[model samples]
Target: QTYKFRLYPNKKQEEQLLWTLEKCRLVYNDMLAGLNKEEKPNRLKLQSMLPELKKQYPELKGVYSKVLQYEVYKLFSNLKGLGELKKKGRKVGRLRFKGKGWFKTFTYNQSGFKLIDTNKRLKSLHLSKIGDNISIRVHRKIDGNIKQITIKKHCSGKWYANMVTERNNKKHDKKISSVIGIDKGIKYFLTDTEGRRIENSQFLKNSLKKLRREQRRLSRKKKKSSNYNKQRIKVARVHEQITNHRIDFLHKLSRSYIDNYDMIAVENLNIKNLVRNHHLARSISDVSWSAFDNMLSYKAENANKTVVRVDPKGTSQEYKYGRDLDRDYNASLNILERGLASLPQGLRKVTPVEIEPLQKLETISASLIIETGSLFQNHK
Candidate 1:
């Protein structure tokens, strides 16, 4: 698990951190250049080149050794990511060199960083080369063994320390009692099998007016001017605010469901294909169904609950229900039916309640005619 905390670096430490980031960026670009020349790019070979690189560019010695090496790892990591995307038939472009402010993070892998607990409100994060007194706000208790620290500078001009840790997760061993199936939608965030509807907050839509205002102000500024940079940060902050609101909403909603239900059933949607529809793409993206599903899965696992992903092929349309039935609620029932079918006999407790049939003859007749026509055509 990774936990992020705000870093309040003193002026001198901030400058040093920025300098280290710049050096890492240069090193990344340099390694990429070298990799391009090589017939077969090797990780160790690229890492070994760092010493020679430091000798060539003596300014690199100012940064910690492990931090510099991680830059090499980061470059290869990007290459690997592109390779994976290409394997999946994505048209990936080559890695581009990091421009001035484009490079925002540098990591201390395995060592060279320490978190100091002063028994006070504000703690200190000590880095090997940067300094020891960089104040860190430990809002929550750090739970596991710390593995590495990644220092990141956000576009909003705020610094954060992301500490990656590892610990064994103990599954919740309590008996399963409650189960639910949720149908995700743009209109309502989700509709559960119990007929509960959580309204979509539409955070991006709400912030777009202020976002546009900041973006327009940014565009009017001269290129690379002081005002332009200042306005850029303003634009970034608006986007950041929208993101924070959405994440907070998702976290709370997912948490509530996890706390209440022992088993959750969600559609295993192919979101990439769903977004192909240009009209509904914006709405689909705004709802962030995939993120919510992921949250439920991980949270359920940690809580020893079950998260079942039923096939999404016909959840919205295949169910036989009356026209008066809420489409989302109907879909939720279908999802629940599929979820119950997929579970073990022992885990299955409550049987799904049957929806009262108020079938339309016209719909049944039309479907029968289509099926009969297809069969007749095949026979002929």
Candidate 2:
């Protein structure tokens, strides 16, 4: 598990952080230069040169030694990922050198960072090279043994500490009795088997105008000018706000469904394929279906609930009994049917009336009942 906390650094500490960032960036660029020259560029090999580097350039001594080593490890990790992607037919590119401000975060894989007074209401973070007394906001409690800490400087000029911890595996004991199906869409965030519709937050769409204005101002400023750098931060914060809002919405919605439903069935959307349509790509990306699915899987696992994915083909095109219905609702019904089909006979007892019809101007309750009943009859 990982928890993020806001870090409040004093002026001296902030300068120390900036100096460390610059040294790490230098190391990264040097490694990239070696790689570009077809050198071995191994992490161990690169790390052994750090002592010589610090000796030659005293500025490198400002950063912790382990933090510098981690930069070497990170470069290799990224290279490995790129190689794997290329194997899978992706268009791969060579690793590039880090420009100023491009390398925003650095990690302490196992040492140089610790927590002070964790049991108390207020806690502080200690960095080995940087001074202690860097105030940390423990907004929420976290558990598990800390394994690594990453320091990130956001373009908004805010700092954050991300701690990666190891926790004992949780055994799920919740008994699930209720089930629900969900259909994802751009029009509505999601439509469920109970005919509940979650409205799309559209964080990006709502903030695009402000983002565009800031971005335009940024482009107009002379590069590297004081105003340009300040405007750049403004643009970054706007983008960050959109991202944070979307993530918050996804987390809450996924948690609510996981807590309430025993089993969750959803369409298996091929998002990569769907996004190929240029016209719908922006809208599809905005919905972030992949991120939602990932949250559902992890949350459901911890809650001892089931998440079943069903084939989406023709789900929105036709109802089971050939009655017309809302596409999203119809998709949800099909998902439930497919999900229940795999359960044990004793647990699979959901009936037609339990699934509600989508809202409509003219009532179709009678036809809905007959259509649902006929669906089971035909299947049985």
Candidate 3:
């Protein structure tokens, strides 16, 4: 995970966020002006200049706002790169300066960060302006120090607190005793070489009917009415529940693979092209193949395992029932059943590494011309 820890922000916390954001915005604007004048815009000097700035620009309104000492500078440091505003340079999403309302948002530095506290081996988190008794859940014990903290508010209006830490990297081996090829399809989420068929959870499919019903219920209520707002939240919570279920399923499934397999080989799906097919697009998203594979990688890395991605061009098509390739794709998914059928019983936990030339795999016969995709993009 990129970061850890949950933020518990109350009403008072919300005010503080707005305050900090506003001040950070001012800091960035002044710096930009200083740079234009060939003046140094250092943080230390900026701290000292705040009083004079407030004195000169009374309209900037100094006395009414909360003082800066209450919050630390590390957590919500001024936006630097794209944050500094690119000239013409096109960008998506609205770019707005941090306003006074953002002071409740806290910044963190390598210092404001801290060790995670566990019920087992004790560790503590230290906040610069705050106390050290912040409670955090320790899932994996590791050697590390907190690097930074970022607290954000999600689109769903929920507060999230993240603690970025420097942790040790894990190591795993390249296991090649066995190889399994997986084909992810719309009908079935996955069909593996071992004949372990995983059914599609189809969370979106299952939730649509109920979602539409709730949506209609929401529409019936008057706009801007209290009842409408209340019903909207209810509808949102339902969708959230379905998403939670899918996320949990992906996490568990990926973990199971990490714990059991030393290597996992999967097709690189071109999501862009796949989504163009309206008929199967919804089904493809429901399975969330990309997310599953991504989670599998880091989790496997942590366990000292490997993830082998083979060219997926002819995986399903090359092996028609009862047919053999004139020249087998360097490795064919269809023939996977034939290839591993003779493996020892105790050797199911490991898989082949990415040791073969992908060009060799690309030479196999495909039912149709396969376009360049994510799989090709990742080829070594």
Candidate 4:
């Protein structure tokens, strides 16, 4: 679970990366549409269709369909999983869009694209217009052989490539090197059973001054003007910096803990309650509580250790109020009618952030997961 999130492009390189995404989208959509109209669409059909489809969309055909070509077929195979779900006719609010601060993108091997560094050369990928062997800056030397590379432009105008690699998890075959319990809290990131404390990164605190200043600058810019666009990029950069700093800080620190003791215990936090306060919304999101849990799970499992999260019921990690240790799992009364009325209206409006791309589930290689209890409970 030692996944690295690195920013890998200089400006000129990033510009062309956008072309790769556009080319991929065009090819993917074309193939998808073509497959939809077929009586029996199969691999050879897709392989044959590429040249014709590209001939029609000369722009896509020009890029030289290599890996992008195979993926079109692979995507068709994967689509079988979703075909049933689509029968319910779910809402699709918008057609897909890629490029700056937008969707995640992939281009295949036949395209002249590859990630690069001062030292090592990664696998070459080619897309139509972008040519083959497009260079990628290797921000850090990766651990495993590169498997797949996806170039993404964040909503913040920052360029990033997520490369997935398969690597042996670090071994931590130490005897219960040490046992520790953790109390997770806002004031303290983690307080262990052995009384060791890890501070909250609080990256937002250090960033707020600059963030507010840049945001204020953005506010003063005339709307939709060159100046405003310029200010928007500036704002995006500030947010990007904050994000990078937080993620880097978390990854390093979590690895540090994993590299140490075995049998690490922690209090299972109720984050929904914490997020109720609007003032803490940004900070909580910045903390990425779910991400932390995800990290701890993978890191511990890969290292052959136990990560036990105890009930928060009698926890006293971050507070000095209300019964000294009891976490009051309070509930507000709601009539039966109110509960039933809330179903369609309230639930439908609550849009959950799409989690389809979370590597946490897919990356856990031979890891053990132990669940203490459910977050949502109903009493009789």
Worst 10 residues of 2 by lDDT: 361-370
Pairs of residues at least 3 apart in sequence or in different chains that clash in candidate 2: none
lDDT of 2 at 99: 84
Poorest lDDT segment (10 consecutive residues) of candidate 3: 361-370
RMSD of each: 10.6, 7.3, 10.4, 13.5
- Per-residue C-alpha lDDT of model 1 across residues 1-380, encoded as one tens digit per residue: 77889999988899999999999999999999998888889989999988899999999889999998888888889899999999999999988988988899999999998899898889989999889979999998777789999999999999999999877887544555678788888877787766566667787887889999999999899999999999999999998898877777776677777877888889999999999999999888888899888888877876788899999887878756555767888888788778877887666566665433322211112122233432122222
What are the Cα lDDT values of the candidates?
A: 0.82, 0.79, 0.54, 0.54
lDDT of 2 by residue, 185-265 (tens): 888778777766666767788888999999899989999999998998899899888888777777766776787788999
lDDT of 4 by residue, 151-204 (tens): 567766655556666777666434443443444555555544333344566777
After TM-score superposition, the amount by which residue 170's alpha carbon in candidate 1 deviates from its true location, in angstroms, is 3.2
Worst 10 residues of 1 by lDDT: 360-369
For model 3, how many clashes? Answer: 22
User: Candidate 2: where is the Cα deviation over 4 Å?
Assistant: 38-41, 118-122, 172-175, 342-380
Best to worst by lDDT, what's the order? 1, 2, 3, 4
* Distance from true location, Cα of 31 in model 3, Å: 9.2
By TM-score, rank the candidates, best first.
1, 2, 4, 3
Question: Best candidate, TM-score-wise?
Answer: 1
Best candidate according to lDDT? 1
In model 3, state the lDDT of residue 132: 52
TM-score against truth, every candidate: 0.88, 0.85, 0.62, 0.62
